[model samples]
Target: MSEPVVAVERLPHALDLPLPAYATAGAAGMDLLAAVSDGRPVTLRPGERTLVPTGIRLAIPDGFEGQVRPRSGLALRHGVTLLNAPGTIDSDYRGEVGVVLVNLGAAPFVVHRGMRIAQLVVAPVSRVRLVERPILPDETRRAEGGFGSTGTGVRSGTDNGGFPASEDREC
Candidate 1:
Protein backbone atom coordinates (compact mmCIF):
# COMPACT_ATOMS: atom_id res chain seq x y z
CA MET A 1 0.00 0.00 0.00
CA SER A 2 1.00 3.67 -0.45
CA GLU A 3 2.30 5.79 2.43
CA PRO A 4 0.23 8.37 4.33
CA VAL A 5 0.63 12.12 3.81
CA VAL A 6 0.98 13.11 7.47
CA ALA A 7 4.27 12.85 9.39
CA VAL A 8 3.96 10.08 11.99
CA GLU A 9 6.35 7.81 13.83
CA ARG A 10 5.74 4.17 14.76
CA LEU A 11 6.97 2.76 18.05
CA PRO A 12 8.69 -0.60 18.56
CA HIS A 13 6.44 -3.09 20.30
CA ALA A 14 7.32 -6.36 22.13
CA LEU A 15 5.34 -7.97 19.32
CA ASP A 16 4.43 -6.34 16.07
CA LEU A 17 1.12 -4.49 16.21
CA PRO A 18 -0.51 -5.74 13.06
CA LEU A 19 -2.59 -3.09 11.39
CA PRO A 20 -6.28 -3.89 11.09
CA ALA A 21 -7.62 -3.77 7.54
CA TYR A 22 -10.09 -0.99 8.23
CA ALA A 23 -7.36 1.07 9.89
CA THR A 24 -4.91 0.92 6.97
CA ALA A 25 -5.57 4.25 5.21
CA GLY A 26 -5.06 5.77 8.64
CA ALA A 27 -5.94 4.52 12.13
CA ALA A 28 -9.39 5.81 11.10
CA GLY A 29 -9.71 6.65 14.81
CA MET A 30 -10.61 3.03 15.68
CA ASP A 31 -9.25 -0.51 15.91
CA LEU A 32 -10.72 -3.94 15.41
CA LEU A 33 -9.83 -6.84 17.69
CA ALA A 34 -9.63 -10.46 16.58
CA ALA A 35 -11.37 -11.46 19.78
CA VAL A 36 -12.87 -9.76 22.82
CA SER A 37 -9.76 -9.10 24.83
CA ASP A 38 -10.00 -7.33 28.17
CA GLY A 39 -9.86 -3.54 27.74
CA ARG A 40 -9.97 -3.96 23.98
CA PRO A 41 -13.52 -2.72 23.44
CA VAL A 42 -16.61 -4.27 25.03
CA THR A 43 -20.33 -3.64 25.00
CA LEU A 44 -22.00 -2.16 28.03
CA ARG A 45 -25.44 -2.48 29.54
CA PRO A 46 -27.06 0.72 30.74
CA GLY A 47 -24.57 2.50 33.06
CA GLU A 48 -21.68 0.30 31.90
CA ARG A 49 -18.17 1.37 30.88
CA THR A 50 -15.51 -0.12 28.62
CA LEU A 51 -12.18 0.73 27.05
CA VAL A 52 -11.28 0.47 23.37
CA PRO A 53 -7.71 -0.07 22.29
CA THR A 54 -6.03 1.48 19.28
CA GLY A 55 -3.16 -1.09 19.20
CA ILE A 56 -0.70 1.70 18.59
CA ARG A 57 1.43 4.25 20.37
CA LEU A 58 2.95 7.23 18.56
CA ALA A 59 6.04 9.29 19.04
CA ILE A 60 4.33 12.59 18.34
CA PRO A 61 6.57 15.52 17.39
CA ASP A 62 7.13 18.47 19.69
CA GLY A 63 4.57 21.32 19.85
CA PHE A 64 1.82 18.92 18.85
CA GLU A 65 -0.70 16.61 20.56
CA GLY A 66 -2.95 13.75 19.46
CA GLN A 67 -6.60 14.34 20.24
CA VAL A 68 -8.97 11.36 20.46
CA ARG A 69 -12.51 12.24 19.52
CA PRO A 70 -15.74 10.19 19.44
CA ARG A 71 -17.10 8.72 16.22
CA SER A 72 -20.28 10.53 15.21
CA GLY A 73 -22.09 7.44 13.94
CA LEU A 74 -21.47 5.51 17.15
CA ALA A 75 -22.57 8.37 19.37
CA LEU A 76 -25.75 9.20 17.43
CA ARG A 77 -27.06 5.66 17.05
CA HIS A 78 -25.99 4.02 20.31
CA GLY A 79 -25.87 7.04 22.56
CA VAL A 80 -22.34 5.98 23.41
CA THR A 81 -20.12 8.80 24.61
CA LEU A 82 -16.50 8.81 25.50
CA LEU A 83 -16.27 9.11 29.27
CA ASN A 84 -13.36 11.44 28.91
CA ALA A 85 -14.22 12.61 25.41
CA PRO A 86 -11.56 14.18 23.23
CA GLY A 87 -8.84 12.75 25.47
CA THR A 88 -5.40 14.07 24.60
CA ILE A 89 -2.18 12.17 24.20
CA ASP A 90 0.74 14.54 24.52
CA SER A 91 3.84 14.53 22.37
CA ASP A 92 5.83 13.05 25.24
CA TYR A 93 3.41 10.25 26.01
CA ARG A 94 4.58 6.77 24.95
CA GLY A 95 1.78 4.56 26.24
CA GLU A 96 -0.73 2.59 24.17
CA VAL A 97 -3.68 4.67 22.96
CA GLY A 98 -7.11 3.74 24.25
CA VAL A 99 -10.49 5.39 24.71
CA VAL A 100 -12.77 5.20 27.78
CA LEU A 101 -16.24 4.77 26.35
CA VAL A 102 -19.60 4.53 28.09
CA ASN A 103 -23.06 3.52 26.96
CA LEU A 104 -25.53 6.24 27.75
CA GLY A 105 -28.32 4.34 26.06
CA ALA A 106 -31.01 2.62 28.07
CA ALA A 107 -30.17 -0.87 26.71
CA PRO A 108 -26.97 -2.82 26.15
CA PHE A 109 -24.87 -1.61 23.24
CA VAL A 110 -22.19 -3.60 21.47
CA VAL A 111 -18.87 -2.24 20.15
CA HIS A 112 -18.16 -4.41 17.16
CA ARG A 113 -15.47 -4.73 14.53
CA GLY A 114 -14.72 -1.72 12.26
CA MET A 115 -16.77 0.49 14.53
CA ARG A 116 -15.26 3.96 14.33
CA ILE A 117 -15.09 4.57 18.08
CA ALA A 118 -12.81 7.57 18.15
CA GLN A 119 -10.63 9.88 16.07
CA LEU A 120 -7.04 10.99 16.40
CA VAL A 121 -5.98 14.37 15.12
CA VAL A 122 -2.48 15.73 15.56
CA ALA A 123 -2.45 19.48 16.14
CA PRO A 124 -0.10 22.21 17.30
CA VAL A 125 -0.64 23.66 20.77
CA SER A 126 0.01 27.00 22.42
CA ARG A 127 1.54 27.61 25.86
CA VAL A 128 -0.45 30.24 27.70
CA ARG A 129 1.00 32.86 30.03
CA LEU A 130 -0.45 33.93 33.34
CA VAL A 131 -0.83 37.44 34.78
CA GLU A 132 -2.28 39.01 37.92
CA ARG A 133 -5.42 40.88 37.07
CA PRO A 134 -6.82 44.33 37.78
CA ILE A 135 -10.55 44.96 37.32
CA LEU A 136 -11.40 44.77 33.64
CA PRO A 137 -14.00 46.90 31.87
CA ASP A 138 -17.38 45.47 30.88
CA GLU A 139 -17.14 44.04 27.35
CA THR A 140 -20.90 43.65 27.01
CA ARG A 141 -24.20 43.93 28.91
CA ARG A 142 -24.15 40.18 29.69
CA ALA A 143 -20.72 40.46 31.30
CA GLU A 144 -21.22 38.26 34.36
CA GLY A 145 -24.44 36.33 33.77
CA GLY A 146 -23.35 32.85 32.62
CA PHE A 147 -24.67 29.37 31.84
CA GLY A 148 -28.04 29.99 30.20
CA SER A 149 -28.41 33.30 31.98
CA THR A 150 -28.93 34.90 28.60
CA GLY A 151 -32.30 33.70 27.37
CA THR A 152 -32.85 32.53 23.81
CA GLY A 153 -34.63 35.49 22.22
CA VAL A 154 -34.33 35.63 18.44
CA ARG A 155 -36.27 38.74 17.52
CA SER A 156 -35.89 40.21 21.01
CA GLY A 157 -32.28 39.66 21.98
CA THR A 158 -28.93 39.54 20.20
CA ASP A 159 -28.53 35.78 20.65
CA ASN A 160 -31.20 33.13 20.27
CA GLY A 161 -29.08 30.29 21.65
CA GLY A 162 -30.43 28.22 18.79
CA PHE A 163 -31.31 24.53 18.90
CA PRO A 164 -28.56 21.84 19.03
CA ALA A 165 -26.19 24.62 20.12
CA SER A 166 -25.22 26.32 16.87
CA GLU A 167 -21.45 26.99 17.11
CA ASP A 168 -21.59 30.16 15.05
CA ARG A 169 -22.40 33.65 16.42
CA GLU A 170 -20.74 33.47 19.82
CA CYS A 171 -21.75 36.38 22.03
Candidate 2:
Protein backbone atom coordinates (compact mmCIF):
# COMPACT_ATOMS: atom_id res chain seq x y z
CA MET A 1 0.00 0.00 0.00
CA SER A 2 1.10 3.55 -0.66
CA GLU A 3 2.08 5.65 2.33
CA PRO A 4 -0.25 8.43 3.41
CA VAL A 5 1.01 11.95 2.84
CA VAL A 6 1.33 14.26 5.86
CA ALA A 7 1.71 18.01 5.47
CA VAL A 8 4.58 19.42 7.54
CA GLU A 9 5.77 23.03 7.82
CA ARG A 10 9.18 23.97 9.18
CA LEU A 11 9.07 27.12 11.26
CA PRO A 12 11.46 30.03 10.73
CA HIS A 13 13.81 28.84 13.48
CA ALA A 14 14.17 25.42 11.90
CA LEU A 15 14.82 26.43 8.31
CA ASP A 16 18.33 24.97 8.36
CA LEU A 17 17.31 21.61 9.81
CA PRO A 18 16.14 18.66 7.80
CA LEU A 19 12.56 17.45 8.07
CA PRO A 20 11.71 14.45 10.21
CA ALA A 21 12.61 11.19 8.48
CA TYR A 22 12.84 7.49 9.19
CA ALA A 23 16.31 6.12 9.67
CA THR A 24 15.53 2.71 8.17
CA ALA A 25 13.10 1.39 5.56
CA GLY A 26 11.35 -0.83 8.12
CA ALA A 27 11.23 1.75 10.89
CA ALA A 28 7.82 2.48 12.35
CA GLY A 29 8.58 6.00 13.58
CA MET A 30 10.37 9.07 12.20
CA ASP A 31 13.04 10.92 14.16
CA LEU A 32 12.02 14.36 15.51
CA LEU A 33 14.93 16.76 15.86
CA ALA A 34 15.39 19.43 18.51
CA ALA A 35 15.18 23.02 17.25
CA VAL A 36 16.90 24.76 20.14
CA SER A 37 17.32 28.44 19.26
CA ASP A 38 20.63 30.20 18.57
CA GLY A 39 22.55 26.92 18.58
CA ARG A 40 22.18 26.74 22.37
CA PRO A 41 21.66 23.42 24.09
CA VAL A 42 19.14 22.77 26.85
CA THR A 43 20.40 20.92 29.87
CA LEU A 44 18.18 18.69 32.00
CA ARG A 45 19.53 17.97 35.44
CA PRO A 46 18.54 14.76 37.12
CA GLY A 47 14.85 14.83 38.07
CA GLU A 48 14.21 17.88 35.92
CA ARG A 49 11.87 18.13 32.93
CA THR A 50 11.57 20.57 30.06
CA LEU A 51 9.61 21.09 26.89
CA VAL A 52 11.76 20.86 23.76
CA PRO A 53 10.37 22.18 20.50
CA THR A 54 10.64 20.53 17.12
CA GLY A 55 9.99 23.82 15.24
CA ILE A 56 7.59 22.08 12.88
CA ARG A 57 3.85 21.95 12.60
CA LEU A 58 1.96 19.02 11.12
CA ALA A 59 -1.37 18.75 9.39
CA ILE A 60 -2.40 15.24 10.24
CA PRO A 61 -5.29 13.82 8.27
CA ASP A 62 -8.64 12.95 9.81
CA GLY A 63 -9.08 9.53 11.44
CA PHE A 64 -5.39 9.50 12.40
CA GLU A 65 -3.21 11.02 15.12
CA GLY A 66 0.47 11.67 15.71
CA GLN A 67 2.19 9.83 18.54
CA VAL A 68 5.35 11.36 19.96
CA ARG A 69 7.41 8.60 21.53
CA PRO A 70 10.78 8.55 23.32
CA ARG A 71 13.89 7.15 21.71
CA SER A 72 15.00 3.93 23.41
CA GLY A 73 18.68 4.72 23.14
CA LEU A 74 18.25 7.95 25.09
CA ALA A 75 16.34 6.12 27.79
CA LEU A 76 18.89 3.31 28.02
CA ARG A 77 22.05 5.37 27.78
CA HIS A 78 21.13 8.54 29.66
CA GLY A 79 17.89 7.72 31.52
CA VAL A 80 16.16 10.39 29.44
CA THR A 81 12.60 9.88 28.26
CA LEU A 82 9.39 11.69 27.40
CA LEU A 83 7.51 12.87 30.49
CA ASN A 84 4.22 11.98 28.91
CA ALA A 85 5.04 8.90 26.96
CA PRO A 86 3.34 8.51 23.59
CA GLY A 87 2.23 12.16 23.71
CA THR A 88 -0.83 12.44 21.47
CA ILE A 89 -1.12 15.10 18.79
CA ASP A 90 -4.72 15.36 17.73
CA SER A 91 -5.74 15.81 14.13
CA ASP A 92 -6.96 19.35 14.82
CA TYR A 93 -3.70 20.54 16.35
CA ARG A 94 -1.83 23.15 14.25
CA GLY A 95 1.02 24.31 16.48
CA GLU A 96 4.70 23.51 16.64
CA VAL A 97 5.39 20.03 17.99
CA GLY A 98 6.99 19.97 21.43
CA VAL A 99 8.41 17.14 23.50
CA VAL A 100 8.37 17.12 27.30
CA LEU A 101 11.58 15.40 28.26
CA VAL A 102 12.59 14.24 31.72
CA ASN A 103 15.98 13.23 33.08
CA LEU A 104 15.94 10.21 35.35
CA GLY A 105 19.65 9.44 35.28
CA ALA A 106 22.27 10.49 37.81
CA ALA A 107 23.93 13.07 35.56
CA PRO A 108 22.52 15.94 33.54
CA PHE A 109 21.59 15.40 29.89
CA VAL A 110 21.96 17.94 27.15
CA VAL A 111 19.68 18.50 24.20
CA HIS A 112 21.50 20.10 21.25
CA ARG A 113 20.09 21.66 18.14
CA GLY A 114 19.20 19.10 15.43
CA MET A 115 19.45 16.32 18.01
CA ARG A 116 17.05 13.43 17.60
CA ILE A 117 15.07 13.89 20.80
CA ALA A 118 11.93 11.98 20.05
CA GLN A 119 10.07 10.02 17.37
CA LEU A 120 6.79 10.63 15.58
CA VAL A 121 4.53 7.74 14.71
CA VAL A 122 1.38 8.28 12.68
CA ALA A 123 -1.38 5.80 13.53
CA PRO A 124 -5.02 5.27 12.66
CA VAL A 125 -7.60 6.20 15.32
CA SER A 126 -10.92 4.58 16.02
CA ARG A 127 -13.94 6.59 17.11
CA VAL A 128 -16.49 4.89 19.28
CA ARG A 129 -20.03 5.70 20.34
CA LEU A 130 -21.01 4.99 23.92
CA VAL A 131 -24.25 3.13 24.71
CA GLU A 132 -25.03 2.99 28.40
CA ARG A 133 -26.42 -0.25 29.74
CA PRO A 134 -27.49 -1.58 33.11
CA ILE A 135 -24.90 -4.33 33.13
CA LEU A 136 -22.26 -5.97 30.96
CA PRO A 137 -23.69 -8.89 28.96
CA ASP A 138 -20.81 -11.33 28.64
CA GLU A 139 -18.69 -13.20 31.16
CA THR A 140 -15.43 -15.15 31.10
CA ARG A 141 -13.60 -17.59 33.36
CA ARG A 142 -11.04 -14.92 34.38
CA ALA A 143 -13.54 -12.10 34.68
CA GLU A 144 -12.64 -9.20 37.00
CA GLY A 145 -9.20 -10.61 37.82
CA GLY A 146 -6.30 -8.16 37.45
CA PHE A 147 -2.87 -7.10 38.70
CA GLY A 148 -0.98 -10.33 39.20
CA SER A 149 -4.08 -12.45 39.16
CA THR A 150 -2.32 -14.56 36.59
CA GLY A 151 0.39 -16.72 38.07
CA THR A 152 3.97 -16.21 36.96
CA GLY A 153 5.02 -19.86 36.96
CA VAL A 154 3.64 -22.94 35.25
CA ARG A 155 0.25 -24.06 36.52
CA SER A 156 0.19 -27.10 38.71
CA GLY A 157 -2.62 -29.61 39.23
CA THR A 158 -3.82 -27.71 42.31
CA ASP A 159 -3.89 -24.36 40.55
CA ASN A 160 -7.39 -22.96 40.14
CA GLY A 161 -6.71 -20.61 37.23
CA GLY A 162 -4.36 -18.40 39.23
CA PHE A 163 -6.74 -18.07 42.14
CA PRO A 164 -7.24 -20.10 45.23
CA ALA A 165 -9.75 -22.96 44.97
CA SER A 166 -12.12 -21.18 47.34
CA GLU A 167 -11.83 -17.88 45.41
CA ASP A 168 -12.77 -19.41 42.04
CA ARG A 169 -16.21 -17.83 41.80
CA GLU A 170 -18.18 -17.01 38.64
CA CYS A 171 -18.79 -13.50 37.47
TM of each candidate vs. truth: 0.64, 0.84
Across 1-171, the per-residue lDDT of candidate 2 in tens digits comes to 777789999999999999999999999999999999765899999999999999999999998999999999999999999999999999999999999999999999999999999999999999876654334346545555567766554333423345333422243
Give per-residue CA lDDT, model 1, range 1-171, as digits (tens). Answer: 343333333334313444423445655454323223435546689888877666566777777787777777778888887798788988889877777888888889876543556767666789776542233333566655566777653223334333243333313
lDDT of each: 0.62, 0.89
- Candidate 1 global TM-score: 0.64
Indicate the residue-level lDDT of 132 in model 1. Answer: 28
Report the Cα lDDT for candidate 2: 0.89
Pairs of colliding residues, candidate 1? none
Highest TM-score: which candidate?
Answer: 2
